[model samples]
Target: MLLAPLALVAACGGGDKGTQEPPSTTAVLVDTLFTFPSQWSSPQLTLKAGGTVVFMFEGGIAHNAIFRLNPGNPPLAGAPADIPPTVNAVVRRTFATVGTFPVNCTIHPGMVSEVVVVP
Candidate 1:
């Protein structure tokens, strides 16, 4: 009797777990001067207007991400604060405004990437 009840419960709990949504993606950044030739894990990333992106700084290296204020990219209303020079830091930013955001590392020259937000 117990085996039959257990079998019924297991059958009732059967559903395709593959239909679930995948885990959120994140970007990893490291100091190019010491780690890799390029600092960015990806040159560019696109996200929805309300989506969030996580930036992971590799350990044992001083790295910071600053949103550059240039001609096209003045300032974003919902941009994350500039990441300070840290050995290992994790920053999350929500893209509320739809625009192209340019990120750079002040410690390393030629280290740059862009994040595009769409509607």
Candidate 2:
């Protein structure tokens, strides 16, 4: 009867929350040679905590994406043991913690970028 319809409505409305929102995605374009545009030309990125940042290289000269392990710490001259030699091609790195990470190129030295994770 009418009670049955009301019960069904209540059950549907009070049931577990709808599917959680999907994690946001951020893109960093790596251009040819020693440059990655300061900002997005199209489809600007909005990063959040625990988000994924993808470095899409577009005909670059074997560029790399190396992030500083520690922001407060000073930059070291040589490469750290943990960081791989390079991060060429499409590279995806997740930011679980919230902070500003300084990224740079190992081969070109001048090329640099950053991944800022907000909580």
Candidate 3:
């Protein structure tokens, strides 16, 4: 009985080991609007500036992300920041600007999501 207990403890590697931290960014699953009520997993996501938002799609109906920017919220610097129609793929977008971005999937009307980036 003593040997079995000791073996169990050893197997667990009992020690003050530092725990690993989770990744900074989180993924949002894109679902079919026809079957599901919503498009993105989360309707709205708020994160600090520089944080990344990952959109993951798993086959089936296609989808995309189009950001609606206005004078108050200018377009993202560099290349067009819209995620093209994609399926069974993962797309990542980093929010460096501090503003509210309204995203929608043109493929499916009323399929909308929002992301707010704060300082």
Task: Report, for every candidate in turn, its global Cα lDDT versus the true structure.
Answer: 0.65, 0.49, 0.65
lDDT string, candidate 1, 19-70, tens digits: 7543334322222222233387767777767766677777567777777654
Model 2 ranges with Cα > 4 A deviation? 1-46, 69-88
As a TM-score, model 2 comes out at 0.47
lDDT of 2 by residue, 53-96 (tens): 65665444455556664534564343222233332365566666
Alpha-carbon deviation at 91 in model 1, angstroms: 1.6
lDDT of 2: 0.49
Ranking by TM-score: 1, 3, 2
| Model 2 residue 4 lDDT score | 98
- For model 1, the local distance difference test gives 0.65
In angstroms, the error of model 1 at 27 is 14
Q: lDDT-based ranking, best first?
A: 3, 1, 2
Please give the TM-score that candidate 3 achieves against the real structure: 0.60
Greater TM-score among 2 and 3 belongs to 3
Q: Candidate 2, which ten residues in sequence have the lowest lDDT sum?
A: 26-35
Q: Candidate 3 — which residues are off by over 4 angstroms? A: 1-38, 69-80
TM-score for all models, in order of appearance: 0.60, 0.47, 0.60
